[model samples]
Target: MALAALLAAPAAHAISGVLDTVVIMQDVTDSYKWPREQLEWNRVVAQLQEQVHTTERLVQRADRMIELMGTAENAADFSAPPSVMTPVNQAVRLETTKHAIESSRNLFRLGSKTRSTYNPANEVKATFEVAGATETRDENRYAHFAMQEAMYARYRTAATHEEEVQGAETALQEETLRRLKQVKTEAQIAVLTASLAASKQRQDLAHQKTVQAKADLDAFRAQLTTEEARKQEADREWSETVVKRMRDKALTAYRRQFRAVGSESN
Candidate 1:
């Protein structure tokens, strides 16, 4: 009986494992909406990244092709396309035109003013200048009043409730003192106290909502700044530094191969 029970236990454990796997598979197959949305979102992000990468590669290749097109080996009248062009020459001209289009798009999108490379000292100087400017102080004051007015306008209910809270507190304090001195009705004092409590609760709810909104705004700004910095770093690395290093590596390899071929022939 003991042997039979032990054998049955192993079989039960195996069955339980298989059942769990089956249930997991069923859950996976039955799942809809959220997972699909998540996958679609991921695909969108991936496609955006891929597009950026392809654009960068295209720009780099176009620049190199333009340089090659200028040389004697690949010289062709790109301006006069009808003047008998090899397929490769025509392709080069097409790529160059595409590069020009991309360049124009970038110029318009980024504005005509060329951005200087990042400089810490210049950044600090600019920050200090802005900080010291009279306009900055004026703007700060304007922003404060504008924000206050906007808040009051948007949250009229909360503002009204806050006013009520203040009035209730004032009435409670002064009325309580007068009632004590005049030996006024205890019911009146109780009513005033309860009004204050209710008003205070309403004020606290409004304050919580305002605080949460401000916190969310601050977090969003922080995230935006961080992402901007990351993007700048990535753009610099990919478009300039990495490209230069790759070009140097290719040149070095070519030189080594050239030397090897010369030695072999000699």
Candidate 2:
């Protein structure tokens, strides 16, 4: 019996050791808390996604506006000026007078003593004086006509040149406005493009953070599951220990009863 008890003692000690291990593993002293950081990261990811969406919408709007501008015709700011009859008549008269002056100048260049002696400045003064008998001086006829024609030509040339300069300036201003508008559109598109790129980059970073957060949350859940399993194993081990003790007591009582019965029969 002592030898049997010695073998059973080692078995009992091994079983107790197993139960102690289970109890140690099942220790749940630490309290559970919500995964706030992980949840907050998820929320951050959602907000970033919304920002990316909004930026994409703005970029699309900018692109649509650019397309419309490309296709749309610009209305003229002002109509072309109408041809004036007065300017046309003045041009024709000037041309006729210019030819007459050229012919008179050629004649004067012939080195005639009378032509050399004729002073054109004096003839011009006399023509404008309003008190001269101009018809009586047939020799000064060419000089007077040349001077008068030259004055008219100068006036008409100045007026025409000024009109041309004004027209050129107006055209240059219109072209400058058009170029400025184009540059503004280009700038807007470039800004939107850069914003889109930045938004996408932010979204990617947010997604990476969210993934990492979720991984951490999953690891935490796994740890909780392991702890729960350990608790269940500990409970099972405790119930087995109770049953073993009761069985041992019942066996001892039956053995004693059998020995007494045997003694009585002898």
Candidate 3:
């Protein structure tokens, strides 16, 4: 959108300048002034003016949209902006814990449900653990993606801010040029001269705002990476420890039951 602002606004002035030049040249070509040539320049000038005006309006709309996206916050408390992609920073992984006490016995076995064919109690419990771990991982992942999106939003807003400053400078420059092209009082020229200097200072401040936004984004991304890694690793360790204990207890019970049955057969 900002790119459109840059290209269309300048073309307007260039097109108008061409039309003015053609009109001046026509004054010296009284013998053979092709009416079509001057007519085409006039049409081009009209089109360019409309394009410039439309683009300027769109830029204004962009600014309004940015303001509406979020309420103002203190720079020191720059938390997450209102986002459709809200991160579950602290997610609940209780499914695995709930299913950890599931019962399993060989008495319920039948054809195709033999030990090798069906999931054992420990295995079912492990499946629950795996599921919880996967969800934990997914929650962390989306959290990271959301943070990155916020960073991108800041970058995009910064870029738009710079483009806005450029647009203002362009308008002031065109105004100054127009005044120079025509007869103006000394006071009128001085006013424009002073306005141009003020515009330059605004441009500098806008540039600084853009730079600071990008820097903030970079810092946030680095911090997010560290936090995501820590969460993933902690969940992994927990899943592994719980599942291992569940499997070991199931195995020990099976071995003791097999021995008692062997002594009875004797």
Give the best candidate by lDDT.
3
The candidate with the higher TM-score, 1 or 3, is 3
Tens-digit lDDT string for candidate 3 (147-264) = 4544555566566756755665666666666765552344444455665665566566666666776777677678777887998999999999999999999899999999999999
lDDT string for model 1 (1-266, tens) is 99988866533222324544632223323344577888899999999999999999999998776554444333321121222123213222222222323343233222124223257453211122445663223333233223332333234433443444445444544544554454233444444455445534544554554454445445544655687699999998889988899999999999999999999999
lDDT of 1: 0.47
Which segments of model 2 are wrong by more than 4 Å?
A: 1-191
Residue-wise lDDT of candidate 2 within 1-266, one digit each (tens)?
99998866533222324544632333232222236566889999999999999999999998787664542233222222233223333333333334535565444422333243347654322223246644332344445444333434344454564354344434544554454455434444344344444434433443443344345445544655687699999999999999999999999999999999999999
Stretches of candidate 1 off by over 4 Å are 1-183, 236-241, 248-250, 253-265
- Arranged by TM-score, best first: 3, 1, 2
Off by over 4 Å in 3: 1-141, 180-186, 229-266
Best by TM-score: 3
The residue-level lDDT of candidate 3 at 98 comes to: 15
Residue 103, candidate 3: alpha-carbon lDDT: 19
Quality of model 3 by C-alpha lDDT: 0.52
